[model samples]
Each structure stands twice: as C-alpha cells, then as structure tokens.
Target: MPALPDPLPDPVAPVVPLGQDPGRAAADRLLGQELRRCREARGLTLRQVAPVIRGSVSKISRLERGESPPRPRDVRALAAFYEVDAQQMRVIERLLEHAQDAEWYEQFSDVTPGFLKRLIQLEGDAEEICVYENLVVPGILQTRAYARHMVRAVMPSAEPEEVDRVVELRAERQLRLMDGPLPRVVALLEESILHRRCGDAQVMHEQLKHLLHAGDTDKVSIRILKMSREWGVTPPYPITHLKFSNGEQSELAYVEHINGANYVTKPRALDDYRNALSNLRNAAASKDESIDLILKAQHRFGDRTAS
Candidate 1:
C-alpha cells in the first residue's frame, strides 16, 4: 500500500459526546446532502455547478453524493453560487470542517483497507448499528485472542507487526463502541460461528464468554441464528447497517466481500438488507435463548480445553 498523507490535527472545537463526532464520512455525506438540496432548490443541475467548481459533472455528482471529501474553496464557490444564507453557509462550513478532521482509524491506515476505514468512520457516527455475520463473530464483539487468530488466518502473508497493528485497531474500535453510551449495537450470528473453531478450544471458550458478557450490556444485543431448513437461504456475506444521528441522510447498508465492500444507500437495495435483517431476527433465537446457546457452546469448548 502507498503511504497515506498524515491526517490533519484535530481542530479545537466544542467536545462532542462519546460516539458522536459526526465522523468524517458522515460529515461528508451530510455536506453533500446539503449541497445537493441547495442545487435542487435553485433548479440547478450538476452540469451548471460543475463549471462553477471547475470540475466535471461526475466530480460534482461525487461531491453531491458525498463520495469524495469536499474542498473548502469548492464549497465556498458553491455556497456563493447558490446564494445560501449566512446560517446555511455556517452549517456548511461546520460540516466541511468535520469532514476534513482526521478519523480515528487513520492511524491504522497501513493495516486497514480503504473500505474498512470508511466503515469505521461511519460506525463512530452511527447512533445504531445492526450487524449480521455467518462466518465468525463481528470484530466489535471479538475477544483479543480471537481477533488475533482471525487476522492471522485471513491475512496469511501479513508480517507480525502488521498483524499486531490490525488486532490493535480492532481492539480500539471495540473499546470506542463498547465504552460509550451511544451507538447501540445489535449483532446476529449464525449458529455455525459457535461451532467453527478459529483457534484453540481455549480461545473459542474465551470468545464465547466475551460474547455473553457483551450481550449482557444495555447497548448491545446478540442473537444466534439457528440452522434450520425453515429459515431458507442466509446472506452469503456479512452485512452491516448503520443508522446515523443525522436524520437527513438515509441509513447506510454495508456488504463486505473478499476484495472490497459496497455501501448501499439506494432505498430499494437498503430495504432488501433491512428486510433480510428483520427476517433473520424473526427466525433467530431470542436474547435469552441466544444466551443459553452461547453458554452451551462455551461449555463445549471449555470441556475440550480441560481435556
């Protein structure tokens, strides 16, 4: 991976409460939404704004869709072009500032992929996170040993230092989410995850125990999806749906694949993931039942370790 530019220092601003930095990605999306609204309200199109910003139509579109970070000059130009009021410009400026601020995950850019970095930024800004996993426990719910083992298994070629950095990144992300009051997390795990051993029996036992403890929290919900013919097909890849504090932008659905991930924002696509999550929830065990299942799995692993 090429070297990434160092993130800008955090600007001195009012301290935001935990789990609420409006995150770089979320801020970009919010700014893009505002810019798009301004254009539409003025009966303008991307073509008209492209020239004003000295960019292409696609560039304007990317800005409007929050695909790229907004440049201050371009934002100012567009604000002037749209003749937005002082208050609106202030809001735009604030969003721009937030968007430019470095994300927490930037420190791990060497180990983190671009798509995963975006997900981490969104996670920080989300008010609620819904996760569905079939392969293994979600990163936020994984114990350190489990995380280390999983990382090594997945990235067989990674150096020891790189592996440690990746595991450290996961630990930091887990800490930020679990140590906060905001960003409620609901995770759905396929029962196979419990049976699929990532490491030694001891590691699996410890991981299951950690899941039980996480599920006991007020802000976290963990449910086990059982393997039954009645439930039909399950999503092949992992799905993460993030609902942000800003109500203006729509919810985002993330699908992770081997190479990269897709961010779903279109209503129809998002609805499909939402429906899948809802159906899985209905088919899965309740919280209490899930706890029982996890306990059983933990004991199974514990017995193996004891032997």
Candidate 2:
C-alpha cells in the first residue's frame, strides 16, 4: 500500500477547501442551516441577532444565507449570543472558507482559469491521481522552459501582460512533485507527445530531461502508449482521476480542444470516463519500459541537435 498522509494538521491552511464548486455550494447551504439552528436554539430572532452584534437584520440574514462570509468578529458575537464556545464556532468557520474559494473552476473562461488552486487541492487532499495526456508531460512534471512554452501556447490571443502572469502561475504549479507531501501520480502519455515540437530544441530538451526526472522518482510512475497500438475505447478526450485521502473521488476531464476543461463527477459520466481510462491504462507500456522509450527519444533528438 502507498504511504498514508500524516494526521491532518487542524486543516487550517485556508487554501482551497475540500470541495469543488458544487461541493462548496452544498457546504454553504449546510452552514447556513446550521447557523440558523444555533441561533434559534438560543431563542434569538433576526432582530435580536442584529442588535446584539450592532449589525443589520439584513447582514445577519446574509450570513445565514451564506451570501457573505461571517466576519471573525461576527462569529465571536454570534457564538456569545448563542451561548456556545469557540470550539463550537470552528465548524461554521471552516465551512464558510469553502464557500469563499475562488477555485470554483469554470469549464473554459481561459486566462489561466484556476489551475493553481485546483492543483494544490488535488495534491494536498488526494491519495492518488491517474492522469492521461496526448501531447505533453502533464504539468506536475514540466520544467520551467517547457511550462512557459505550454503556457504561451495555451491562450495564444491573450494580452502580453496576461500571458506573462499565467506563465508564472503554471511554473508555480509544479511544487509538490519536486518537494515533499506529494500524491501518488500515475501518468499515461501517448507516444506522439515525444515527437510533437512545442518549442525550440532547447526547451524540448528540458522537457525530456524533466520527464526522466519524474520517472526516476520512487512514487511518481509514468507509461507511454506507442502510436501503433490498436486501442478500442477512445473517448477522444483527456481524463484524470483524483482519489483523496478523505474518500472523495473526482475525475478531471477536458475536451480534445484547447481550453476545454471540466471537473467531471456526474456518476454516469464518471463511469464512461473510468471505462476509457481502464482501457488506455491496459494499452500503455509499464513504467520501467516507458522510461527507456523516452530516454531513447531524447538521445535521438539530442544527437540531431549536437550535429
């Protein structure tokens, strides 16, 4: 079995909380209901709640509705008003943080969307992730040069300043795999990812070197499927699976076109994607041999560059 994560450290990072957009939305609803229960159980009406904290009825209602966050002071006031201790208030506080996550991913609003937040949550909470790619070393394994090239290419029409900012964000997304507290990441790459040229020889070489580094790591595993293999279930899409330590499972799927991304969790859709993933995994080379294939391609390209 893979190494399990250490006991969660009070879980107070305030980073992306443990919910996707829909998950957060539901959490918000529950927090709202709980807030009302706490207040009503103490015989406090909306009017009494407002004056007790010197806020408006509208403000109290808004907090209960999760339309706005409960300020720290507001939480203190309410806890006192409800005759509860600070520890009891913690549950509400944590749930509201999930409501505030900017990481609610959009399918494709472009402009770098929310990759950093999504990446952090996926690594911090997940036990394992299985990823498939068609034409790149997935972001977790990308070198700076390769990442910059891919970022520049991702949104070709963005303003110059916006492009630069996004490239910086992509480069930052590689932290976990390089350092500690990483997830068990298994990747399957199509053979053509090797031959496709994203940048000049220098950047491409960096990418290949980075892939080798990833393969050599004890926990990170990668496999490549040769182009000649006749694979049966083609979803014509890219898919990723993330299994969290909390028993939460999600599929990160995107359309074949650039900029199309969706965190797929509808049961029926997940079933179809899971079937496709199982087939693709079966067709790919094992980690040991995949590294050899990648190294050979690197040598061939390097020879061409040297001559």
Best by lDDT: 1
Q: Report, for every candidate in turn, its global Cα lDDT versus the true structure.
A: 0.81, 0.65
Worst 10 residues of 1 by lDDT: 1-10
lDDT of 2 by residue, 1-307 (tens): 1221121111122224334355555666777777888998888799988887788999889878877655656766677778866776777666655454334333223644444356555554466778888767787777777777787786677787776666555555456344443468788888888878878876777688778887788777888998877855344445667666654444443322344345555565555566666777888988777888888878756754453
lDDT of 1 at 70: 86
Error of 2 at 229 (Å): 1.4
Error of 1 at 200 (Å): 0.4
Q: Which 10 consecutive residues of model 2 have the lowest summed lDDT?
A: 4-13
Model 1 C-alpha lDDT per residue in residues 119-181, reported as the tens digit of each score: 776676688999999899999999999999999999999899999999999998898787557
lDDT of 2 at 109: 32
